[model samples]
Target: MQNGVVMEETKLEPRVGVAVFVLKGKSVLLGRRRSSIGDSTFALPGGHLEFGENFEECGARELEEETGLKMGKAEYLTVTNTVFLEEPKPAHYVTIFLRAVLADPNQVPQNLEPNKCDGWDWYDWDKLPQPLFWPLEKMVRSGFNPFPSQSHPLHSC
Candidate 1:
């Protein structure tokens, strides 16, 4: 519909994501995005995967970038497939989830990216706050546990 020429809608490709489930004292870290796609929703510390970066590297980088906290060795946890078809700019992402503890338990989290995140807090996985980001909601619905050394964690949320 531009210059009397009919144009077809452009398609969007799925983006890859890496999210870290930072566990501390039986609670996981969650942050509320401010002006981004999933505004007002609680999400983990994560971002788009950069080329040539592994999941652990991406998780650590994103955690530091967003919360100013260093992430310890991240363990492969699970994955989520979420499609934001209801968004103004419908998009899809295949997010890889990783579990990590803080490199230093005494180090507190700070809001490094105020424009993106409101703040960070810890919440129990089973008692997560409402209106979670789609990727996380999907993962929680699947009952994927981030706890360590638990039998049947995959079957228990």
Candidate 2:
């Protein structure tokens, strides 16, 4: 059964991505995904981290690409790991979070991949967008913030 038999192959390790919460004072940014990837719908400002870049750097780069905002000051927030498992587990992802402030709040969002996402907006903390992505909602519940130039690595705020 040459056609019916399954082929064996090596699997690559999971890659890491960084998501940034671009907070302008009391407001936070959220984006709407035009396309769907399984159950993931709306998502925060984030994407895969490139080689030789730090987590914070990746966050800043992704924010600019997705929202057209130049980050002022971004601080480390938190990180998470996720695995996509259906009938067969295909890929795993490690995500890092950073909280950044925008240099200009008035700037409009321009999608890096216009075919993938519709647009973005700044929403109050109390009101997260509808059809929200689970990972982002979880991050919101964590109550994390970027403390201004504290000695400690993890900010208390």
Candidate 3:
């Protein structure tokens, strides 16, 4: 406690999330959410972080779980804190992005949860579909490449 203020550490409440940019040479993978939640439209391949998990582990685990590809070394990227001004019921989220290359381009990503996700596809950076996730669009706009040799530090390990 400093300045007569009680500095209690909050429980955090599972506010951490991770998104991985699965790269396949010249393409990035994007999945369509069939889930009632989310935008129910466009979203990246990621989910909530598990208990006692670090950012890298969460990112790699989520990527493989959702995309069926093991992640190699992932780069540390800037974390974005999202606070919904209107929704007050624990709407805070911190998202970490990482660059991951596909282990096999020939293997297709199956819908592990068919009820939640319809399918997945590899999209060229230059040409992406409309109504993508806002953060994803921003990532593309900010020139975040998944290619390691040329990707930014935030994109590569």
Candidate 4:
């Protein structure tokens, strides 16, 4: 310790996040974020990965919690490294993407957490909503597509 002052270690680590790409026909589910991090931007049904949870488990839990939809089989998509340089909190996240079909084909998406999201809606992949969340924007920019037949080269586990 310099000058007898104790130094505390600063903990700065990339947060692990799980995002679900729920597809219905040629459309994908998206929600308008109302949270402070990415307010007013469209994002997937996702959240931070809880302790002791795998990617699929986290994706299923987040999808149900955020959109009130039952999660079916989730396939691993791709990982995105997101850095929010413009945000007030200045956060970093390593988000794992997963594609899941709804357990019930007729199930509707809802905004279960009003404080964090506005509502869920479906948008065509070729024409997504404006101002996407950082991770999602990155995914789109990298040509990531949930539709396996689109030839994006994403594999399911």
Would you estimate the TM-scores of all the predictions? 0.87, 0.77, 0.73, 0.87
The top-ranked prediction according to lDDT is 4
TM-score, candidate number 3: 0.73
Over the stretch 24-97, how does candidate 4's per-residue lDDT look in tens digits?
A: 88899999999768999999999899999999899989998988899876799778787777887778888888
33-72, model 3: which lDDT tens digit per residue? 7643444556778888888987778887877777676776
Instruction: Summarize candidate 1's per-residue lDDT along 1-157 as a digit string, tens digits.
Output: 9999999979799999998889897899999988547888999999999999988899999999999999865688888788887877788888988888888987788899989988999998779998898778876787767788765332212
Give the Cα lDDT of each candidate: 0.85, 0.71, 0.70, 0.86
lDDT of 4 at 131: 99
The TM-score, computed over Cα atoms with residue i paired to residue i, of candidate 4 is 0.87
Residue 135 error, candidate 2, Å: 1.2
Candidate 1: segments with Cα more than 4 A from true spot? 1-9, 150-157
Superior candidate under lDDT, 3 versus 4? 4
Give me the overall lDDT of model 2.
0.71
Extract clashing residue pairs from model 1. Answer: none
RMSD to the hidden true structure, all candidates? 3.8, 4.0, 6.6, 3.2
Worst 10-residue lDDT window for candidate 2 reads 148-157
A best-first ranking of the candidates according to their lDDT comes to 4, 1, 2, 3
Ranking by TM-score: 1, 4, 2, 3
